[model samples]
Target: MAVSRPTILIPSFNTGPLLLETVEAALATGYPVRVVIDGSTDGSETLLEDLTATDNQLRVHILPQNQGKGAAVLFGLEKSLEDGFTHALAMDADGQHPADSVTAFLELSSRHPEAAIFGRPVFDDSAPALRVNGRKISNFWANLETLGWGIDDSLFGMRLYPIRKLIETLEETRFARRFDFDPEVAVRLAWKGVPIVNLPTPVRYIDPEDGGVSQFRYLRDNTLLTWMHFRLMIGFLIRSPWLGMRGENPLLHLSPPAR
Candidate 1:
């Protein structure tokens, strides 16, 4: 196997000034950073043009129109793969994800290259109660679908994925291309027998006054999740037997060597 080469991938959509901040922080981790502008009409991609020119560590890819978060990420993954990146640490550009944790997650990925490193969000008061509580519904179904494969938080977007395995998982379904991306991918990857590792990471919700923008529509997203889980339940019923006997990935049978 080739040596693990990881890149920080941020998918942004109309995140305004926060986009620059997120990109800068990711670059600060000394990793190659790629940002996919998901058809943002706010002139946000232009904000990084000058910086991207001067900094070899940063690159920006713009889409003609908004295709949703998952589509944006899939674009990044395809490019990253061509760039020879073995893994990708994906985080949000809306200032909710902690960029400082980039090194930790990447380090964990380096140690366990075949496993998925997920961020188990530690939310502060800045996080909205309704949103936090609402995610529980999705999490419950995700765990059940995977036969309790240890998905600490299904909706958290700050996670590191092996580029190849993730692409394969995404190719298996076309519906994870929008708001349903995060949770659906997690559950499906678990079903594929990818080992999961979760680490506690702080998540902060920025206020609008501070240039924080949220694309979440409570009713619409929740409905999407409901439909997503309904489909996953049917899949689970079909896969549970195989998943139970599978136990774990053979790559995970041995302990990771200490760093």
Candidate 2:
């Protein structure tokens, strides 16, 4: 059996100062943390200069140009694989995801090493109503596309994935390399019959005064998601028969890991 070496992965694109804070918190979890600088022009990667030099636990990879969140994550995953990591917990560089919850998620992944462990966000008042409500639409479609598979939150970025499974899933598709990454990956993983594990983690929307940088563009991103679901829906239709046999709670099946 291959031993699991799980790492916290933060993909940043012009995330400004929050990138440093996020990396620091992740490093504090005592797990190796990898940051992918996705062609960020804001020089945000510079913020981690000191730590990267001093800390062996933190490693940063830079892309020549911005390639979207999904691309950044894919880059990180490839590096993680090369570095012998078996799993990656992906979180946004923005301050929304809680750093303290990293240990719990990794611990859970340790026990259920073959499952995709998702963070079901417990939102505070800081969460924007539109963003909160918008995700419900994505969640609904995600569940439907998976034939009612258990997916607590489809668009949550803070999720743990078995590195190889996730890479194989991404390699089979090209559409999820941008804003559609989160939801699309979740739905596709379900179709592949990976077990679902959801844990409630508190999420905060950092105020602008606190140096929060949001890259989300409502119309552009939403249209991308709509198209993504449309494609997924078609794929789901073709595979529903197999997916249906996976049962309501696929985790209970717990098939042996891939060779």
Q: Candidate 2: where is the Cα deviation over 4 Å?
A: 252-259
> How does candidate 1 fare on TM-score?
0.95
lDDT of 2 by residue, 1-259 (tens): 3777999999999989999889998898889999999999988888999999999999999999889999999999999999999999999999889888998888888888888988888888999999998898888899899886778888889999999999999999987999899999999888888888888889999988989889999999999999998999899899988877777754634322211
Give per-residue lDDT, candidate 2, residue 53. 98
TM-score of each: 0.95, 0.95
Clashing pairs in 2: 39-65, 39-66
Best prediction by lDDT? 1
Worst 10 residues of 1 by lDDT: 250-259
Model 1 alpha-carbon miss at residue 231, Å: 0.5
Question: Where is model 1 more than 4 Å wrong at Cα?
Answer: 248-259
lDDT of 2 at 167: 96
lDDT digits (tens) for residues 195-238 of candidate 1: 88887889999999878899999889989999999999999999
lDDT of all predictions: 0.89, 0.89
